[model samples]
Target: MYLYLQQQIQDVVKEFAKRQFDVDANVVVNQPPRAEMGDMALPLAMELARTLRRAPRQIAEEVAAELKKLEIVERVEIAGAGYVNLYFKRAAYATAFDQRTSGASTGKATGEKIIVEHTNINPNKAAHIGHLRNAALGDTFVRLLRSRGRNVEVQNYIDNTGVQVADVVAGFLNLEKKSAEEVRRLTEDPAVRFDYYCWDLYAKVSRFLAEQADGKAMRSTMLREIEAGGTEAARMAEIVSTAIVRAHLKTMHRLGVEYDLLPRESEILHLRFWDQAFALLKAKGAVYLETAGKNSGCWVMQYKGSETEDETAANEEDTKVIVRSNSTVTYVGKDMAYQLWKFGLLGKDFYYQPFHTYPDGHVVWMSSSERGKPSPAFGNGKIVYNVIDTRQSYLQDIVAAGLRALGYAAQADRSIHFSYEMVALSPRCCEEMGIELSPEEQKRPYIEVSGRKGLGVKADDLIDRLTEEALREVAARHPDKSQETKELIARQIAIGALRYFLLKYTCNAVIAFDFREALSFEGETGPYVQYAVVRARNIFRKLAEEGEGAKPVAISEATLAKFLAPPDGDAFWSLLYLISQRDAAAEQAVVTTEPAAVAKYAFQLAQAFNNFYHRFHILTEQNPERKAFLLWLVRKLEEQLTATLGILGIEAPKAM
Candidate 1:
């Protein structure tokens, strides 16, 4: 309705301005700062004042008169220096909301195949709170796209062959000096989280190599053995990386995040996916020998230019060294190859095998040669979204550049780098974690989280704390509730709190995680939103159990169609308005890809419902007609909130 009202006002403004200026008129509409100012306010008077040589207020008065002629305009007034305030019939909001919002923009994306690569953390350690930000944002992003009728292949890239994995191998082989079977037995212990064990082991090897003056050459030896495969290093890496990858999956499952595939780095290399891509780049002249420059020994590609125009904008360095004088490819080269395969430009494919079927009945495909059957088509998506952090912006840009260089412009244009800022600890949390800050670190707004140093909150630790706090609150509210019921409520609230927190910030903004702030149950938190929904549910429960107990209130598909169709004016129209927005939100999130906007809207909608609850009593209303309508409205709000929360990977708790 806001849009239609604005359109009507614009039409009137055009006629009024044409009479005054003898030319076409243009106007813009905006939301009023205060709802009371109007549902929407127009500030066209200032634009006319300059053109007509008249004061803005006088111009506003004339425009207001022109708009008042419409029966839809309940009131039109001039405010401030020149703004034209428009108030539609109160019922018009519900009416327009019902009709216009039924089909809000769900993005231009069709059911086209799209691949989203995210949460590609090395399977080296327990996922920390820092890792949750990446997974949470990526999962919510996928939810938004799928909500818009887009088919998404969510891949969790496993860096099982990276240097981080190698370090864990060094710890198990050279340091602990354990055999493959013995190491497997040690890792399988129930008391120790396999990921947590390797996390410390990786850090241990890293420290020993860097600080132990005698250990420098051992790192090279370990690397060589791992690269050769079939050695102790490779065997140990497989044990550590595979185990930790499963642990990370378990952690993510707790937060309602799951992957459609687990694409391992070793498979990419072993299956010659990179080799095929290298051949393609070479064949296309996208990469060539750098025989004359300082990069003489490298297989180099010319620096591909960016979109912006500026003569000096070309990277001064003529080439990116894909392979140094040595035969081994850099991480950049591996990534370039991966991108090619993902977009199907490399003409190579991974043999897919069923990795695991999740508890939720979702199947996760893994790249493997042990494929005993035919495959579900994967990769070569019309669009690709890689969820990574901003620190890797340069690398991501280079990947896009490589695509363009290789004549994959279409894919480059659509391959989005869904970058987010790192998670750091607030001073309070840092202190609580027993971390000491340097003067330089203290000067910044937050302390940098360090996985190498093991100085950030572990994901499980935060979940435990949140659950405990939630359980305490639940206990207070329902003293007679059984311990099992309390535990269940606590689990829901804890999951909601963490998922909402991970989502409530723009992807570009670094989070300064604070224990005290994250534990809050009141104001701008996930539990607060969950509580509102629970209260709404309780209201309905009360209605069902008591009062004139009118005919049982229920919603149906036919009713929902009418609920969102023309003459949609009602207290419930706004609730239905949000359903259409889920798609638009995903598209906006595609550009911003920030989960915070979705998270913020989820809470804002809940807030609106909560306030609506206070203004009216659904069961107590004497008029049967009004009471019936209110009950339907309440039912819709409850349904919408529950759906919105599901998109955010949050559950609406049955009780607060």
Candidate 2:
């Protein structure tokens, strides 16, 4: 309703401009500083002042006169140097909001498929806290798009044949002297967590590679065998990476994150995806052979760094090697092929097989080298969003540039890089976790975590810690509840705290994770918002037993309009206004590709509802008409806040 009214007013201004001034008016709508001022304020008159050489205040008066005629507009006033303020009709606005069939954007579908590829963890070790941030942001963005009625497919790309996986494979063979059968036995042991064991071994191997003489050669041989895919080293790589990928899925599932596809790097090699992409690049002259430079005998593509836009300034430093002299394709080369397949422009497709099935009956498919049972068609996306860390922005740019060089400029424009900063442990949090820090680290605001050094928190470990902390709180608050119920609620609260903590910051801002700040039930934390939902539900439960009956009071729109007028109505109207803007917030979040917008909206809605809960005593009020109005407010606020939380991928428990 808020978006519709804003558009209606903009249309009115455009029509008025074309008729009266014989010109077009590009209007921007904003909210006033205070609710008492107006709901929406537009500076159209000031914009027209410069174009028409007329006084802004004079133009404002004319526009106000015409805007007052709109049914949705209660009145229009000109304030402070020609600002056009619009006051919505209270009854009409309430009726429109109640009539809304869907909380998402005007109940319309874009008719285009959007693919979001995220959680591309290298299948070698356990997922760390840094990877958690990527998954949370990506999953929340998928929810936001789905809430806006978009057709979305979630993909978790698995680099099962990458250097990271090979490093761990070398650790198993050269360091442990373990055969493929022995590693498989270790993976199947009930007491052993294969991923956790590999995490420590990976760190040990990393240190050895720096200290020992033959470590680099060992890793190179292991990598070559894994890429070739027919040797014992390849079989061990398959076992280790597949087990680690399963561990990653379980970790993500605990946070309610699931994917529709798991595209693997091995399939890209076995099925010749790179071969098709290389042919296209060669046909278009997108790459050439380098002869006499540092990158001699390599196939290179021109890279125009952002430092300079002049194409004539190309030099040896401006070249990126796509294929080396040994006929091995680089990571960027395979990524270009994957990006093309996403848009269905590669003229090649992957054979998919079922990878895993969730309890809810959603089956995740993985790329295969051979045909399998029937499955739904994948790819052919109108837009593709790759959720990666900020450090990979240059590689993402090269991928988009590759598309553009091949004359797929439209697809290149639709390829979005959803990048974010790293996650670190707060100084206080490190102390809580019993991680001894150096004196220099203690003086800093945050401590950086490194997976290669085994200094990072595992995703599952963090979730378990949060759940334990929440369980203590839950036992204290609701001691009489059953153990199962308390445990379930504790898990929900833990996930809510963890996800909200990761999402509350903007993508570009670094997050320093702290336990106390996230679990607190005050301020802008997730528990605080969750408690508001509990409070609202408690009101309705009591009303069913004490008020008129279990059924809601059938109040007229006229009565709602009365409470929205004069001295007392502004408070109720303000709350209602914000509630109606939930869909608009979702649309805005999608446009900016920022999940923080929706997270912030959910927090604000919670705050407003809590204020309303304190200001009005609904059950004890004697006047039936006013009591019915207050009850209606409580219902609307709870519904909207709960819906907003769902979009953030946070669930409100039955009780806090």
Candidate 3:
């Protein structure tokens, strides 16, 4: 409702500028510092003062007079040198709120498709906490886009032919002495989580390669065979990577994250995506073969910021190799091709096959070398957001530079790298999890998790732990509730705790994962907001038992205007204003690509609702009309808070 009023004011002010002053301008709307000042403020008069050679106060008075004609604007006052403060007509605002149901249509449909690629974990082992942060951030952003009426496709890239997967295959073959068939049987066992097995095996391979020089040769041989295909090593790679990919999907599903497609590096190899990308690069002079220096015989592109006094020195010092001396295409080269396909700039397409069917009836497809069945067309996004860690910022830049070098500068410009910092464990969290910390590590603020060292929490393990703790709380509070009911509530709270914890931090900030901080019932946690929802429901439940019906019916605008008039109702009015700004908060979150904005808004709304609850006794009010009005306000608050939680991918349970 606030967004609607803001747009109305902007249109009116923009037209007023063009007609009265003969000047074209952009009108920006902002909130006043205090609610008593005004609901919305426009400082356009000060902006036009110098251009029109007039005093700001005089221009503000003139604009304010014209703006008073708007139906939604109750009055416009000029204040403090040039500010135009606009107040909403109380009855009109109430009518607008009463007319629309919760979760009404948001922004207009944008025809362009947006592809967001995140959770691109290597298909080698179990996903860890770091991967959970990536998925939570990406999934929440997808929800925000859809809420704003965008056509979005979620893609999770798989690096099946990368060194990580090759290392696992080497461990199976050389270290464990397992044949291809034996590995396949192990993957087929329903009781065995193959990814968890590889999690430890991957770490062992890393240690072996570091301690023994001969182990390096085995890894290289396994990588070549996996990429070359038609070998036993390639079959083992397929079995392990395919099983691990399924495990990853299941892990993410527990958190309500889903994807439309999985584009694999193996498919990129079999489908010759790099061959076409390489041809384009060579023809456009985006990359060239180095004949001399340390990079001899390798195809390389000049680094983006490598300019120096001497051209030779610059190229020698900062060239990024696209193709190694052994003729293997680098990860960046393959990523360039993948990015090009996202925007429909690449002249090639991937054959796709259905990879898995989710419980919700959504079919997730995977890229294939040969067409298996009719599938929906993938890629061709007008804009793409790659949610990668900050460590890969340089490689991401190179991918975008490749697009610009090939003359698709417009697509390159639209390519966004939604980079974020890594997630680390808080020192307290390490102690609580029973992981011994070194004396030096204990003094640091946070400890980083490394999958290669087998020193990280598995995503599933953390979820299970949270669920168990939540169940204990629920059982204690609702002792008589059925076992199934308690379990369901526990799962909802656990998921809400995890998703909110991962999303509440800004993208550029490093989060130190701590269970106690996330699951706490008070102060900026998911359970706190969720408890607000449950409390509001209890009010309605009590009213229903007193014969007021199961839900509060809408009160007339005339009654609202009388009750919300002044002094005594000031707190109530303020709470209503906050509830009406949900759309504005969602728009801000979308524009910034930060879920933390919405999460913070949810916490604020929850805080406001709790304060209102304590100040008023709705059910005990003797005046029937005032009671109805308070009930109506509570219903609106509940609706808006629930919608906000939905956008953050958090569920509000019936009880805390």
Which regions of candidate 3 deviate over 4 angstroms?
Answer: 22-26, 50-53, 102-110, 214-216, 434-439
In the order shown, what is each candidate's alpha-carbon RMSD? 5.2, 2.3, 2.1
For every model shown, the clashing-pair count is 4, 0, 0
Q: How well is each residue in 1-656 modelled by candidate 1, as lDDT tens digits?
A: 44345566677778778886685877777657875576568888888788789999988888888888887677888999899998765444444454443355466544778899989888888889889999998898888777656888899998888777877777777788888888788778888778878777777888877887767567656656665578866888888787888888888988988998888777777888778878878888888876764777778776754444553335336468887565556677888888887877777788878867788788888888455446678887888898999999878888888888788888888988988999999877777877788887777789887777767788988999999999988999999989999999999999999888888888888899998878887788898889889988887778657754634454343544444343544445454444334444545565577778778877887888777788777767887666666676666567667767878889887777
Error of 3 at 46 (Å): 3.6
Residue pairs in candidate 1 whose N, alpha carbon or C atoms collide under 3 angstroms = 94-568, 94-569, 95-569, 589-593
Error in Å for residue 463 of model 2? 0.7
Please identify model 2 stretches exceeding 4 Å from their true place: 101-110, 305-314, 431-440, 547-554
Candidate 1, residue 331: lDDT: 71
Judging by lDDT, tell me the better candidate of 1 and 2: 2
- Who is ahead in lDDT, 1 or 3? 3
The TM-score of candidate 1 is 0.85
What is candidate 3's lDDT per residue for 499-608, written digit by digit as tens?
Answer: 88898999999988877776665688888899999999999888778887965576788988887776676787888888988888899987888889999999999999
Q: Which ten residues in a row have the lowest lDDT in candidate 1?
A: 562-571
